[model samples]
Target chain A: MKIRPLDDRVLVQPLEEIESKTSSGIIIPDTAKEKPRIGVVIAVGTDEDLREKVKEGDKILFAKYGGEEVEIDGKEYRIISRSDILAVIED
Target chain B: MKIRPLDDRVLVQPLEEIESKTSSGIIIPDTAKEKPRIGVVIAVGTDEDLREKVKEGDKILFAKYGGEEVEIDGKEYRIISRSDILAVIED
Candidate 1:
């Protein structure tokens, strides 16, 4: 099952968080939590200017809480509007 | 502390979820969790077209997961690209 966004929205597959911790080395138990921050651009919207700005296969840093969640092929993806994108990752 | 997003991004303040559950009536433990879904548009972006599309004080539904997190006025807000907005709430 393929998912596509309408207008300037995009479909993103979020990256899984590492089981290990970063700075404090505090293992984040399921209790203490925040939103997910990293993701991959799966599908681009139909806006031309936006299309020029971003493309598919771009690994982007999106807002941890930006798009709507939809299940496709048992995988979770976000259907977000164009305005919510922050920056496109270059690495 | 005021935070404004750059470019086509908007500063969004996410709404808090209710303590109760939705359909299943199952209390979502602090462990089994997901990201936030609703937010209010705070600051509009710099892009002229995007600004025209969305505005300040708009209650919007964004992707369940989208932008970067910032602390402002001791509150957490998401700075997301305009593309992450799904629909603008009129009510």
Candidate 2:
């Protein structure tokens, strides 16, 4: 299932969170764990200017609590506007 | 204390989360809560082009799971790249 962002929004699939315990070997129970804040860009918006600014596969760093929450195909994703973007990762 | 961002990085102070229980009044324990994702722009980067792209006071929506986490004066913030920004709020 392909997701498309409207206007200047971008669809992102978050990177998986660490399922194991932390470096200290303290197993984090489900309640104490923080949701993962890393993700991959799935699709960009229709804005020509935004399209010129970013691409589909660019890796980026963004706010952990930004964007609107969305679930697709039993998976979770976010729809964030282009202005919320922080940086484009080169790699 | 004032913070400045380098290059295209943006310094954002996240908005406080609901300290009280959720609407359901379930009294969500801290262990089961998620980190706050909403933030206010503390500072914009030094890139002139990027500076023009964004401003210091603009409210933005971004990826919930993005940016590098940093601590300042015992407070936590994130330094996200510009590309992670999703939208600029007009209001």
Candidate 3:
């Protein structure tokens, strides 16, 4: 079954970041660290202005504890309100 | 100096509740109790739609961890975002 977010909400698929080395040769570990709130937009809400600003497949930056997790068709996704979105990650 | 909230925020003076006995003879103790998120709107934000919904001196219900506290002229108040407001209480 498919889920459609209502009002000024969006469905997002969170990007899980693993341990990685930075340019400074420092290892950033994901274990015990706050999960990054970055995600890709799966479905945009029906709000006209919000739809104009955010499109499907666009990457987004959301608040640290913003979205609600929902399991759909064995896939995990988050439903985030418009106010919780911090910015649209450009490029 | 008088404070004016910008955007879709509101300035509110929290209404603190004290220990009181209910009609059911249940003495509702205030000690160790979570502070109620109810307050009177001191000032409304500049957003037109928000202004239309909330007004100064209006009693409102806000999210538990929604607003930021600030002291103005020795009086404590909270700055709450529009999305954090749950409902406007009517008397």
True-vs-predicted CA distance for residue B43, candidate 1, Å? 20
What TM-score number comes out for model 1? 0.45
On lDDT, the stronger of 1 and 2 is 1
Identify the runs in model 1 with alpha carbons over 4 angstroms from their true place: A19-36, B1-91
Better of 1 and 3 by lDDT: 3
Over the true interface, candidate 1 deviates by an RMSD, in Å, of: 9.2
Candidate whose DockQ is highest: 2
Error of 3 at B14 (Å): 0.4
Docking category for candidate 2? Answer: incorrect
Q: How good is the docking of model 3, by CAPRI class?
A: incorrect
For all the candidates, what are their Cα RMSDs to the real structure? 12.2, 12.6, 12.0
lDDT of 3 by residue, A32-75 (tens): 35534777898876568999999998878776567555443445
Interface RMSD, all candidates in order, equals: 9.2, 10.5, 15.3
> Any runs in candidate 3 off by more than 4 Å, and if so which?
A1-91, B19-36
lDDT for B23 (candidate 1): 24
lDDT of 2 by residue, A1-91 (tens): 6787888888877655442122112122233133224456889999877777677876554556778999988898889876566555443
Per-residue lDDT of A28 in model 3: 30
Residue A19 shift from truth in candidate 2, angstroms: 9.2
> What TM-score does the predicted chain A of each candidate obtain versus native chain A?
0.75, 0.71, 0.76
